[model samples]
Structures are given as C-alpha cells and as structure tokens.
Target chain A: MRKDSRGFKIAFIILLSVLVVVCFLLGNAKGTIEIGVKRIFEVIMNDDGSTQRMIIWNIRLPRMILAALVGVNLALSGAILQGVMNNPLADPGIIGISSGAGLFGIAILVIFPQHQQFVTIAAFFGAMLAAFIIYLLAWKGGIQPIRIILAGVAVSALFGAGISGTLVFYSDRVYGALTFMNGSLSARSWPEVQTILPYTIAGIILVMIFAQKLNILILGDDVARGIGLNVEATRLSFTALAALLAASAVSVIGLLGFVGLIVPHSVRLIIGNDYKYMFPATALFGAVLVMLSDTFARTVLSPTEIPVGIVMAVLGAPFFLYLLRR
Target chain B: MKNDIIMEVKGLSVSYKDNKVIDCIDLAIEKGKIYCIIGPNGCGKTTLIRTMSRSIKPQEGHVFLSGSNIFKLKTKNVAKKMAVLYQSNATLSDATVRELVQYGRFAYKEWWKGSYEEDTKIVDWALEKTRLTDFQKRKVNTLSGGERQRAWIAMAIAQKPEILLLDEPTTYLDISHQLEIMELIERLNKEEGITIVMVLHDINHAARYADELIVMKDHKIFKKGDPWTILESDVLKSVFRVEAQITKDMDTNKPIFYAKKVI
Candidate 1:
C-alpha cells in the first residue's frame, strides 16, 4: 500500500508538470498569431511590446490561470463534499450548489447591475442557501445521500427555472448573461482571477487541514463520532467550505458542470481513497483536466471559442457512464 | 454506588420523534467486567447502547463517565475514555485495515500532525490484539464478514479506551466466528481490564460470555444480575417469552439455556 501510494504521487507530479507545459503552450500559441513555444517563452521573458507578447500576458495567461484555479476549487470542493456526505455522486453542479450560485449571479447582473462587486458574496450565500435547503429537506432523522441528491435535483430545477425567468425578463441586457450562463472562460481577465484568488487559496488550505477529518467522515457518521469527531459540527463546517469553493469558482467561470463530479472520482481511482493524498492529487488532476479541456475548446474551433463547459460535458459524460458501468 | 463504577446512566429515557424507545432506566457499569444487554428485536437494546455511547442523546437524564457528565465533555475527551462499535461496518470509502485503524488515533492527533511513534505502536498493538496483523494491508471491503467485524474491533481497540461499547457485534457472524469475537472481547476484559458493555442477540452466547447480564423487555430493563443467577428458565420465559431449559455447563460453571419455543 505504501509503495503503491508513493508511486501514484510520483506519477501525478510528473503528469502535472507536463500539463503545465501543455497548458502554457496551448494558451499562448493557438489563437490568431500561432506563436511557437520558444517564442512564447521569449516574449514572456523579454516583453518587447509586440503583439504576441501582449496577447500572451494580457489574454491567454490570465485565462489559463483562472481555468486552473477554478478547476482546483471545484474539484477539491467536490472531493470534500463527497467524503462528508458519503456520496460518490455528490458535486457542486449536480447537487444544486452551482445553480444556486448561478441564480444569485443572474440576480446581481439583472437587478443590481451597478453593484457588480456583490456577485461573489451573493453567490456564496446562494450556494449555502441551496445546501441548507437540501440538507433540511433530506433530514428524516439524518441526511441520507439518496435523499439529499433527490432534494438537490428538485432544488436545481427550481433555481434553474429562476435563472431562465430572469434571462427572459431582462432580454435587453441578455448577451453577457447568455454567454455567462453557459459556463465559459472566454475573455477571462486579471480582474476575474483576482476575484477568486483569495477564496480559492483559503478554501483549499482549509480542505487540506481537514483532510484527515474527511477520511474519518467517509466511514459513516456513527464511526466518525466513535473516533472522536464532532460529526455534526465537522460536517457543517466542511459543507460551508465546499459551498465557498463552488461559489468562488461559479462566480468567475459560470456554471461549469462535471469538473467537480468527475475529477475527484478519477483521482480516487488512481490514488486510492486516503484523503491525505486524494485531496492534492484531485486538485492537480482537476487543474490539468480543465486546462486541457479549455485548450480543446478554444483551439479545436480556432478564433471561434466553444464554451469550456461543452467540452467538459462532452468528455465527462462518457467517463461518468463508464464509472457507473464499472 | 460510586466506588467502582466506570460508567453510570441515570434516569435515561430516549425517544425518536414521538415514540420513546428507551424508557427511564439506570445502569451502573463496574470496572473490568463484561456486561451483555440481550433482548428481542426493537426492544431498545441498541437504543440504550447508542444513548450510553453518546451517539444519540437521551431525551431525559445523564450519562456520567468517571463522575463527569459525558454529554458535557468534549467529544475527543469522551473518545479517550470510551469507544463504540455499531453493527454495520459498511463504509463508502474503501480503506486498508491499517488506514482504518489509524483513524482511531484521531483524538490524539492535531490537524497538522502525522502518525507518531506512539500512535503506530498503539495501532500495531490493536492489530495484534484482534489477530489482524497479517491482514493490515488488506482492503476492508474485500474481507469476509468476520474479518471486517474484527477490523472494526481493531479500530475500537486502537482508540485505547478504558471502556468499550459494542452494539450487536456478532449479529450476522457464523457461530465459530461469533465465538472467536466473544473470546477476543473476553480476553480484552480479563487481561486488559477494559470495561465492556455489549448488546448481543444470542442468549446462549451472552450467558456464556458475559459476567453480568441485562435483560431488556418492552424498552425497559427487566432484570440485571450475574448471568448464572439471571439466565434461569423462569426469567427467560418471562422476559424473552420463550419456554427455556436452563442447565449448568459442567466445565465452566456458567448457565446454558436452550429455548424450546416462543411462549
């Protein structure tokens, strides 16, 4: 077991390095200019006010970094929620958390367009609200995974309908809302990266710190309590942290689906279920998965970018089905 | 009353929603004794154990551990004093036996700390005690029912508690495996001097293993005494509603009961 885990760790680190190189090259090379890896690195180092340099620094780098951060956040949150809730299928998007944030994002965009700064905060509250409702509705003695998932599906539909209603009602300001609703990394900028950075760092740190607790949590609540965990309190705090992660990502990247659902599951398949390793492995792999998907989304069609969400869904759905089959 | 009691339940009544599962009852568990609670299904044996372990809060009354109210103590402090093993050892996350047993050291660990030498020593001791040393690296899900149950016991033993509470520890095991677990638990009580309170479904097993017997009927304690004294034909008929034949084991001097039919 020890040797197998150590092997997985080494392989994961090598994979992450390769992905970083690939992500940097794809982000810098493919757009309109088609710069080489050598030129991209030179431009980054020299900064001679050329078009390629401007594109690399201003547009592609920020977008790539945002995608990586958002992916890590979503994946870590998913891993934590799956452990705490003891549900393999738990994810921010599928469990109504992202939709709740999406509704709040739309509300801010439509109703209080001037107060754009409140979107992240509102999204956080909205995510927590959805989680609270799902948990409360699922509570019949205790929250079972099946009950919570069913409640989440219901809550997702409700909030999804609310988002559509807002979009239809405010058709005048619909263009930005339309693209944002589909989960895109298009035209992502430094400001968006800045918005999610603090929360993402803090949330990831908190998840790592509580990784051992999460390991205990997956043992079921009774066992968790038996091992000295304050089960309810640990669960509540972990749920809130997961909400914060998904809300932070959703606020920046719109409603990206399946990144949270699939990344951790795949990571677990490779690294095993010990959360101490699973947490970091999932975060890195999630970043790579999204970076590669975003690279595909932007370059596959070239000059006309598809939503990264579409790319993720196209790739993730089949993998999810395969997991179910297994 | 206070001299040798390791655990005390006073006026404990537990309910679920509108239905009371465990009516008002009191129990004092002496140190280094094996106590078994036996009753029919849904007669509140598990509920009483759950309440005693602080997994479920009683609607009324207090459980005192070493003269302190257990509910008022921090969870880690309580865990240091007592460990519980419920019936189901199922988990969504699959772990090796070593990893599962390592979790028992959570109370002694800080967030940033990894396993210390002391933790490893305790975990090793637990694995040895449960005879799981060879299976330490085996995945828990792949183990047979008896081995998996022993893994759970190893985890509880790893906690190194003075008191251990088990809810239906031998429910689904084969007779031989059940005897194995009972002997292991008895050794813990006798050699390690750990106070054990367990809910067992089999009356014969309880009579053979337990130093003291608690017979529950209709959500209340019908009788509590030494198993040799309490495991009589009349007591079994009245409390268990079974026409029973009671005899003494010539070798061990313990009561042996054979139930003919439900009365």
Candidate 2:
C-alpha cells in the first residue's frame, strides 16, 4: 500500500506470472502423452478432437484453473478469518469450517451418491452451520477468539468422527472418499470448476471491497467499534463470506488442509498486515503455492499421483512449527 | 435536555448474565469538560463508560450523544461525535503509527476510496498532537507502552470527535508515563475543547486532571461534582474503601489525595 514496497510488489507480480505459466504447462501434462509448452499453446489456440487437445483443454487447463481459484478462495478466507478472529493461527479447517463442509461432502458421497452435483451447495450450508455453531458456543458474553477456537476444536473433532463413522460403515466407497478426504485433484473436470467459479469470484470481490474493514477489524472488536465499524454486523457478514469461500473450496477440493493457513502467514511476512495489500498478495501467493504443489503431487510419482493435502502438510507443518517456536 | 449537554444517559442499566454491572445510572455530561469516573475494580466504571460510548448495550435506557440516541444512530454518525479508547487495545500484528492513525479517518472515507489530502493532513496533525510525528512509520508493537498508548490516543484524535472516552488510559504505565498521558489528555481538553470522559484507577490522578469527578459505589453514582467539592475522606472511604488524606494543591488549586491504607 506504500511506495516503499513497490519493488517487492513488482517482483511478486512477475514471480506469480512465471508460476502461472509453469503451472499451466505442467498441470496433468505428463505420462505417455506429455504436451510441451508450445504444443499446449497451439492446442489452446485450436482445439481438435485429439487426446492431446482433450488433455490440455478439457482436463489439465480446467484442473489448473480450479486449483488456482480454490487457492484464492481458501487463502482469502483464512486471511479474513485471521483478521476477524484476531488470531494468526486461524484457518477454515482449524476452526471446523472445512470439517463441517467435509461432513456434508461425505454425506453426499455416501448417502446421496446420485445427487453428487449437490455437494457444493450442501458444503456451503454445512460450513455456515459450523460457523454459526462456533459463534453461538462462543457467545457467553461476546465472542472470544479463544472460545471460538476451543469450540472449533470440539466441533471439528465431532465432524471428523462423523466422517470416519460414515466411511467405516460404508467401506465400499472408502477409496473414493479417502482420496477426496486427502484432497486430491485427480479426475477433476470443468463441472467442478463451474460449480465454485461464481462463488469464488463473488467471495473475492466482496473481500477486496471490504479489505480495508478487515484491517480495522484486526485492531480488536472494541477498537473497531470506536472507529465506527458496526462490529457485530461487519464481523457476521465477513464470517459468512469466509464460510462461503472455504465451503466452496472444500466441496471441490475435499478438505484441503494448509493452503489457507500457510499462504496468508507467508504473505504477511512479505507484506505487512494491511489487508489492502495483504489480501491480493495472499490471493496470488496461494494460487501459485497450490498450483505448484498440485503439479508436484501429480508428477512426483508419475501416474501414481499423491494427494495435494499430503504435499501441503509436508511443506506447511515445518513452517507452522517454526512459526510456533518463533 | 440542556443545550450544553453533549452526552446524556437516562436510566441506563447493564447486566452481564445475571449480575447487574451498571444499575439505573443517569448522567448528563456538559460540553468541553474533562469528567473522570473513579471507583474500585468492580464498580462498573468501565461498563458505564462503555454504555455511554454504545460499546456496551444497556438493559434499559438510551444514551443521547449531541441530542441523538447513540444506539439508534448509525455507528459512523455516532463516531463522528465521539471516539472511545477502550482499556485493552487490540494487539496489532504489524501496524505503523501512520497506518493506525489512518484508521481514525475510516468514518470519513468510502470503503473503495483512498485517503483524501484533507484526511492525510488531519492524520499528520493528529500524529503531531500526540508527539508521534517522527515515529509515523514505526510499527506500534515496537514502541514502548507509553508510546503505544499515545498512538491509540492519536488514532482517536484523528477522528476529530467532540467527545473522547478513555477506559483506564493510565492503568499499566509508570508514574511519569501516567503523568505524560494525563497531561496529554488535559491539553486536548483545554486546547481543543474536547469533552473527555475517562475511567481512572488512581484517585489522585482523577482529582488532579479531571474538571469533574463521578464517584461510583455498588454500581451506582455515589457523588458527582467538582473534584475540590467532592474530594472528602468520607467519600473516599465509602466509595473506594480507602483511608486517605485529602489536600489542596496550592499551584493548581485542585484536590489531591494520599491514600494511607485500604480500609
């Protein structure tokens, strides 16, 4: 937001552009029909009925875009929650939002397998419900961050158990549910992207518009009120917005863990806590982080793809531990 | 409903769970005066101030700021008339003095719009008033406790409000830093005609700096008058449960108290 940080901004922009290009080229572009960057561009320019064009157009491109969008949603959601809750460690998953969405996702996967298209909608409701429950539980006098977190831990464990019990009884769908729970992007197509696109865009627009308020909100609720912020209304709306974003991501990605947690924390280290810069920066950085990690997950084993959640946890856990020590 | 009344509360009562923290309190604060509320730890001083600022909602009654019901008005509109510095300031992760002060101008600007030149000028003026002009770019966390308190006050000052509410503005500071904050507050009241209502822990500081004092006992106003008129040993004993020597300062002609023991 200041002139002094112009160089860093420009550098990060360039870095993000390069990473976007790399992600587009490498996403699912492996195995027997590996498409080169030039070939990928040619296919994008002219889509034939060939398998190569199909891989680039119908499969990899959509997957890549969806990954990036999910990253944007999750990171922005985390950034806003961290600000609203006034806690750096807050993320959608840690606060039980992702798990709440995950419960609905598993329900759809198991019970309403025929109505798989309803997963995103169900997840949104579930996420909002979780947020509402957390808010309600934390409402002894007013919502305290510690209480929300404690309630979150309790609620998350509840949802986690629900997911486990559902899977345990319905062991027939365990493979699909396990992959989804581990947060894989395998076999993901344009429909999944279409499902979350409008919500993701809407969430981003809302966050960008309200980013300045988020900056004030980080100053504590009472201080925010002093500055004329309708603290309760603003916080509720932002929480709903955050829940919507995280739920959208969860429905498609199946409870991806650390994109929300790591991206905002890392971006704050680069840019300060001013949400004007921090939100956008978190968006770009989160997209790149997820895209790159997804690429690694796909190519590292070459056809035996690992889950992106595993990749993120491998990368994020140490960073989290280090931050904790600091 | 006096014309000079800037902020007035009528029959205000606030309850937390089952306990009534502030009970049926009525107060009318005249414009351009420094009023301090002093009592023991749990006498609801903070709650009363918070209710007046609309930070705490009363169970029954309304707070009128500039003749408008504070809770009924839009938050930004109420903010234009009064700004409050709550006791526990939210810990900012990384905020420069300038950026923190810029938040004070939030009510003036649209969400999408940048700070106008006028806003910038006011922010600069606020920083200068708090003697933090040179430290504008310094992160607030990096400042000393006294300096951080000044930053918070500067942020409030940037609101350009007629009334400023401070809850224990000098709780954690050393004696000299306490004096520094009290002096700054006194100067604001005198020079800018800012009506200040603060909850103070120290009886002497309240008596020395405040033009008027509201002594609270058992969730009610025990007494309200000029510090010189009300600073008696019996009032101190009943209100704060302390045995004290009340003396007049020859220089300031204000009442000063020396607490010998907590009775």
Candidate 3:
C-alpha cells in the first residue's frame, strides 16, 4: 500500500511538471509574436526584466493561476460532496450548486451593475443557501444523500428558471451576464485571482484537516455515528466547505462544468478513495486540466479567442457521455 | 447485581414524526454477559438498541451509562463508554481495512494529533482479534460478506468501549460465518468483561448464545430473563405469534426452539 501511494505521488509530480511547462508555453503563444522558450524561461527567472515579464506576470499569469485555483476548488468540492453523499453522480453541477451560483451572479449583474464583486459574493452566499436548503429539506432526523440530491435537483431547476427570467427581463445586461453564466475566464485579472485565493486556500486546508472524518462519513451516517463521529455536524461542515469552494470557483471563473465532477471521480478510480491523498491529488489534476483547457481556448484561434467555457463544454460533453456509457 | 449493571435504559420511547417506534422500554444490561433482544420484524428491537447507544434520541426517557445521563454527555464521551455496530453493511469509498479500523480512534485523539502509538496499538489489537490483519491493505469493497462483517466488528472493537451494541450482526452471513461471529461475541464477553447487547432474528441462536434473552412485543419487553426461563413456547407464541416447541439442546442444555406451525 505504501509503495503504491509512493509511486502514485511520483507519477503525479511528473504529470504536474509537464502540465506546468505546457501551460507556460501555451499561455505565452497568444501575443503579437510567439514568445520563444528561452525568453519565457528568462521572463520567469528574472522579475521586472522585460516586456515578456509584464505579459507573463501581469496579464497571463493571474488568469493561469486563477484557472488552476478554481479547478482545484471545483474538483475538491465535487470529490467531497460525492463522498459525503455516497453517490457517484452527486457532482456540484448535478446537484445544482453551480447553477445556483450562476443564477445569483446573473441577478447581481442585472440588478446591481456597479458592484461587480457583489456578484461573486452573492454567488458564494447563494451556493451556501442552496446547500443549506437541500440539507434541511432532505433531513428526516439525519441527512440522506439520495434525498439531498433530489432536493438539489428541485432547487437547481427553480434557480435555472430564475436565471432565464432575469435574462428575459434585463436584456441589456444579457451578453455580459451570459459570459459569466457560461463559465468563462476572459474577464479574469490579478484582482480576481487575489479575491479567490484566500477562500480557496482556506477551503483546501480545512478539507485536509477533516480528511479522516470524511472517510468515515462515506460509510453512511449511522455507521459513522457508531464509531463516535458527530455525523450531522461533520456532514454539515463538509457540505459548507464544498459549497464555499464551488461558490468561489464560480465567482472567479464563472461556472466551469465537469472539472468538479470528472477530475475527482477519475482520481478515485486510479488511487483508492483515501481523501488525505485523494483531496490534494484531485486539486492538482483539476488545476492542470483547467489551465490546459484555458490555454487551448485562448490560443486555438489566436486572434479570435474562444471563451474557455465553450471550449470545456465542447470537450467535456463527449467525455461525460463516455463516462455514462462506462 | 450492582457490579453487573453497566448500562440502564429507563422509560425509553422513540418516535418518528407522530409514529412511535419504541414505547417506554426499560432495560438493564449486565457487564460480562451476552444479552440478546429477540422479536419479529419491526418490533422496535433495532430502535431500542439505537436509543441505548444514543444514535437516535429517545423522546421520553434517559439512557444511563455507568450512572451518568448518556444524552447529556458529549458524543465522544458517550462513544468512549459504548460502541454500536449498525445493521447496514455500507462500504466506504476506497477505504482500506486499516483506515476503517483507525477511524474508531477518532474520539481519542484531538484534531491536530494524528493517529498515535496507542491508537495504532488498539487498532492492531482489534484487527488481530477479528483476524483481519492479513486483509489490512485490502479495500473494504474487495472483502467478502463475512470479511466485511468482521471488518465492521473490528472497527467497533477498536473503539475499546466498555459496552458493545450490535444490531443483527449476522444478518447477511452464511451459517458458518454466523456461528463464527457468535463465538467471537461470546469470547469477548467472557474474556474482556465487555457488556454486549444485540438484536437477533433467529430465536434459536439467541437462546443458545445469549446469557440473557429479551423478547420485545408491541414495542415493549414481553419477557426478560435467562434464555432457558424466557424462551418458553408460550412466550415465543406471544412475541412472534407462532406456535413453537421449546426443548433443551442436547450438548449445552440450553433452550432450543422449533416452530411447529405458523398461527
């Protein structure tokens, strides 16, 4: 067991290194001229040296880091929710958390146009509210995962309708809000990265601290309590953490789909479901996948950039279908 | 008798919405004794056990463990006093047998302190006792039905509680596994001085294995005593509503039952 985990860590490090290099190369390929490898390397090594440094550090760096952070957040949230709910299908998207955040983001954009950060904050609170409602509605002495999913579906549909209604009523703000709703990284800047960094870091750290409790929770509430865990408290805390991560991701990068749902599930299949290892691994893989996807979306057409949201949907939908078939 | 009374449940009643599942049931569990609650399906046997373990709150009663109100104590405190093995055999995702067993030590350690040497010793002892040391590295999903049941038991034992509550521990096991588990429980009671309370469907097993037998009917204790005294044909008919013959086991001279006909 120790050997297997050690080997997985080595492989994960190699994959991460390769992805980092690829992201650096692809991210810089977009400017007036294709930045050479040596220049990009030099730009990273020496701060405040050249125009390449400004482009890499200021413009592309924040977006790249934001993409990575949001990816890790979504993936970890998805993995934690799936484990707590004990259902393979219980991703943030399936349970309506992402849509909840998107709807709230739309509302903020349409109703309070001056406060852009309010949209992100609203989305965060909205995701938490949705999760809380799901917990309360599904609870019959204790929260059951099946009931929670059912409640999530119902709440998600209601929010979905609310978003559409807002779009219809406030047509002027429709285009701007649509970009955020669809989950894009085009508008992300250093400020956006700074906004989400604290929450993402705290969320990841909290998950690590409670990793053992989560493993017990996967055995179902009754069994968890049998071994002395405060089952309801543990579950509520986990759901809140997941909601925070999901909300933070949506707030920064719009509503990226499938990263939260797919990355963690795939990791679990590869490395057995011990969350201490699973959580960090999922975070790394999620960050790498999103960074890579954003790079593709930005540089694919070069001059006419495709929104990262569209790129991910186009790529993720077929993989989702393949997963369903499996 | 004072030394024996390790756990006491007084006037315990549990309800879900408006429906009462367990109604004012009282029980006293003696230390170093194997006690079994036997009843037909949905007779509140499981509910009673859950209440005693504080997994489910009793609406109108108190559970006293070593003379303190169990409900008022912190969950971890209650857990240290007693451990329960629920009927559901749900496997955790990607949990190895060792990790699962290690969870039983959650109450002992604080948030910052990971598993300690003492925790490891207890888990190791439990795994050894349950004969699951060979399968420690295996994922819980990979285990057979009997192996999984033992794994759950190993986890409960790792808690090292004074009292153990098991709800239908042998429900899904084959006959050999069933006997193996019963013998393990019997040994734990005799050797470790741990009090045990269980709910059993098979009256014969309860009669043969348990030192004290409790027959619950209509959400109340219909009879409670030694299995020999309580496992009469009349009590069986009253609780299970079936006509049965009660006789002594040839080897152990314990009460044995054979249902003659369904009434």
Candidate 4:
C-alpha cells in the first residue's frame, strides 16, 4: 500500500542533483596536488597557464566531464533496457553489449588501423548485433529475464574470447588496450569529453520524450497494445536506442562497468518504476556515482590509480547479489 | 442492418505453432448488449475474445469494427472505439492504482501535449465508478484480488470506449468477488451502454450477466442464443460434458445451473 509520493521523488531528485555537484567538486579537489575550492576558483577565474591550471583544465576537468557523460549514458541505457526487456538485471556491461562494443572498438583500433575513425560506428553495429543475437537466443515467443541473462553471459564470454584472440594476434598493440579493457579514466582529456557529450544529450532527450511509453510498456504487451501502443514497434525502437546508448558509451570509455546496474536499480528502489521520474533521477544519480567512483578510483591509493570499472564491479556485484536474493 | 451490427467477425481463424486454436468463425455483434462466450478450458473461448479485440492476428478472414476492417484502422483509433481487459497483466508491481488508471488516457495524448484537466476528470470518474477512489493512492499489488480486478476495470473504462472486451474477467476470483464482478459488468452495460463481450468459465455467471450466450466447444461455436434458451440441460451436457440442472434465480429471475458428474 505504499504510495508514490510526488514530493518525495522531487525531493530525492533535488538531493541527487546536489550530490552531482558535490561529486564534481570532490573529483576536482582530491588528487596528488590537492587544491582548495578558493585556489581552484582562482585558477578558473584567472588562468595564467600555470601547472595547477593545466592539472585542472587539461586533465581533471575533461575526465570528470567524461565520467559524468558515461554515467548518464549507462544509467539511461540500463533504465531503457530494464523496460524493453522488462528485467531488472539487464545491464549493458553484464549483458554482452559492452563486450560487443569492445571487440568491435578494438578491432577498429588495431586490425583496421586505417579506418579507425569509424570505430564508434563499428562499435554500434557490434552492439546491435549482440543485442539481436541475445534476443534471438533468449526468445521463446517472449523475452524471459533469465533466458536473456543466460544468453547474454554466453555472448559476453564469446565476445571476451574474440577480444582476447584479437589482442594475442596483435600483441604489439596490447599496451593501449589494457586501460580500455578495464575502463580506466586516466589521462583522458577534452577530446574524450567531446566524443561522449553529443550522445549523452541525445540519449537523455530521447529518453525523456519517450518516458511515457516505458510506463505503458510495464503494463504488459497485450494491455499496451490494447491501449493503442504499437507494441512490437515500441519494443524494437527502445531496444535499439538502449544498444546505441550503451555502444556509444563503450566506444568512448571501452568496457566501463556497472553504472547501468547500480545507478538505475538504486534509483528505482528509491523512486519506484514510473519512468517519468526514474529516467531523470537515474541520470542524475549516474552522474554522481561515476564521478564519485572515479574520484575513489584515483584517490583510494593516491598516485597509484585503480581502474574505475574495478571500483564499480567491487560495488556492483555485491548489490546485484543482494537484489537476486531479495 | 449493417449499422446495428457494431462488430462483425467473418471467417476468422487463428493457429498456434501450426495447430489451429480457433476454427473459422463468423458472428455479428449488435450494439449496446452484453454477450458472453462460455466454454471449458482450452476450448478457444479466450482465443476468440482476443481475436475480436485484435489482440491476436487471425490466420484467415477479417474482423470489421463499425463496418471497417479493424486491421486497417490505426491502433489508437481502434483503442478509442474498443478497450480490452485481461485476467492477468505484466503490471509494474509498484505502480499506484491512480497512475495505472491514468495510462488509459494514452490514446488521447498528442505528440506535443501530454494530459489535460479533462483527462483528470475522466480518471477520477473512472475511479469513482469502479468504487476504487479510496484505494487509488495505494499500490496495485497490495490490493486484494477483487480490488485489483476493479482497478483494471477502472483503467479499461478510463479509455472511454464504446465497446469493452474482457477475457475470463472473473476466473481467479472467489465466489463473492465473482458476484461483485458480474454485477459490475452488468452495471457497465446497463448504465454506460457499453457493448460488452466477455469470455467466462462460469456458466451461471454468464447466464446471469449475458444477454446472449455463445457456447463454444473444440474451437467452434456449439450454440448461440439468449441465456434462457442456451443454458438448458442438453446444451450444458453437450458443450461442458456435465449433467447440469437449469434453475431460475428467485430474485433476478435469471437462469442458473447446477452441474454434477461429467459425461
């Protein structure tokens, strides 16, 4: 009999928004050369191209922005996947989508070095292919969550093997692929930020605009159809959009893990599954989570960094188990 | 003649995995009446109802709504004319009853604008009509079976349809809840003038609520008539394989049946 209180959801969103700002600032301040807010503002307000300014402007700022964008992409994609498949466990990272993107992304980088510019497009195609194969394998007239997850695990393993085989064959290029395979945020600058921003904005807008469809979809396909939805068409469009969002994020971050699973699931656990609020809430929470997790990844053993994907998995797998048991 | 026949099913047949579930069936639905299709389990009663609501695509033949092919019309247009309620739905378990009912206004939503005061009024009206106004704020899964059924009915009626289709609407309810649902269906037909087409497992409930009874057996219609003529002992034993004694309800003067051993 628990009610979905609008005030509670709006207030929680406000709290998450506040957390996003806090995460950004924490990420900005904590590092080898820790700078106070006043010093940071001083550099921003008056840039004389000093060492601190370079550290803030060239390194920390862009990476933080990229982290936030990845957060938005993964969280929104996860939200859509949960709706499209009607399963809570449908994360891009866990469901072979990231593996698909990684395999295609690495292939573009190492195998076809000349056409490396089409890496993002190749990654998207791979992700779509992975999604289609999973759907084909999992479908017994309808998408069951367990079947999809099992199929995803198999596809993910297969793609992981493909990535491994590619690296061994092209062993000379393994150096660059290491950070990518672990989804690190080290040394990424403005170019990475620029690569991910447009996709994030596009994914967010589309998710908001189609939020109502997700709500209708939760009512089951037959009822959704009876209520005038082109049920099959809606499912296809949303699934593709989910894959595209996840692929674009992976194209930039290269196999980043579990912002999808953790952020959206936690948000829904708080706000419930009305996508109108859940999408935006999940987006904001995602920004906070990744920025914070990246900060933790960088600072937990300062000067010696851990990959943010490791941080996310250490946090996510346990939470996933908790949900499964519940 | 065509105008009075609000929906016409012509040579409609549906198959599942190459096994025919619904044989070619033809029936005409007159406007502003309650019709019930009754049969044993797996007799294609559910399939026929689904086909009529366009939930299932027939393998052959056409279903015409308002003398136009239903398949040709836009989905929203069909939804606006007819609304179907199912016995079970893949509901977001946490959704509030009011929120679920509000989704029924989906067809009226434009590309730009979402909702209006008019929609709110209709939603509230639906909640009131279903006697679920008090429970509208509560989660759907937390409600009792009867209350949940009413909530679904509220959502369906909120579509503001001229025709309503329900597939085994009271199959899972207790006897008291079943009576409540039948009375509610009767009210929706009599008060709102909504043409009702429902599939029911309970013959007595159908005999009481249905103005016309369509008895189905083995994917084909066994008999079709007014309940008084259709609920006789011979038809019941033939269609249901039961020795059913027909009786009259003392208060409502409707035909009721008591069935014993199967044939």
Instruction: Give every prediction's interface RMSD.
Output: 0.9, 1.2, 1.4, 1.3
lDDT of 2: 0.85
Q: Relative to the true structure, how large is the alpha-carbon lDDT of every model?
A: 0.87, 0.85, 0.82, 0.87
Ten contiguous residues minimizing lDDT sum, candidate 2 chain B: B106-115
RMSD in order of candidates:
1.8, 2.5, 2.4, 1.8
Mind giving the per-residue lDDT tens digits that candidate 1 earns over A54-142? Answer: 98889988888898899899998899878877778888888899999989977897889899899999999999999998988888866
lDDT at position A167, candidate 3: 82
Question: Which CAPRI quality tier does the interface of model 1 achieve?
Answer: high
Docking class of 4: medium
Model 3 Cα displacement at A322 (Å)? 4.4
| Segments of candidate 3 deviating more than 4 angstroms | A1-6, A30-32, A44-54, A114-117, A140-146, A173-175, A322-326
Ranking by lDDT: 4, 1, 2, 3
| Chain A TM-score of each candidate structure, as shown | 0.94, 0.92, 0.88, 0.97
In what order do the candidates fall by DockQ, top score first? 1, 3, 2, 4
Q: Judge the docking of candidate 2 as incorrect, acceptable, medium or high.
A: medium
Identify the candidate with maximal DockQ: 1
User: What digit string (tens of lDDT, one per residue) describes model 4 on residues B65-119?
Assistant: 9998998898888988899998777575478899889988889898978668989
- Model 4 RMSD in Å is 1.8
- Count of clashing pairs, candidate 1: 0
Top model number, lDDT: 4
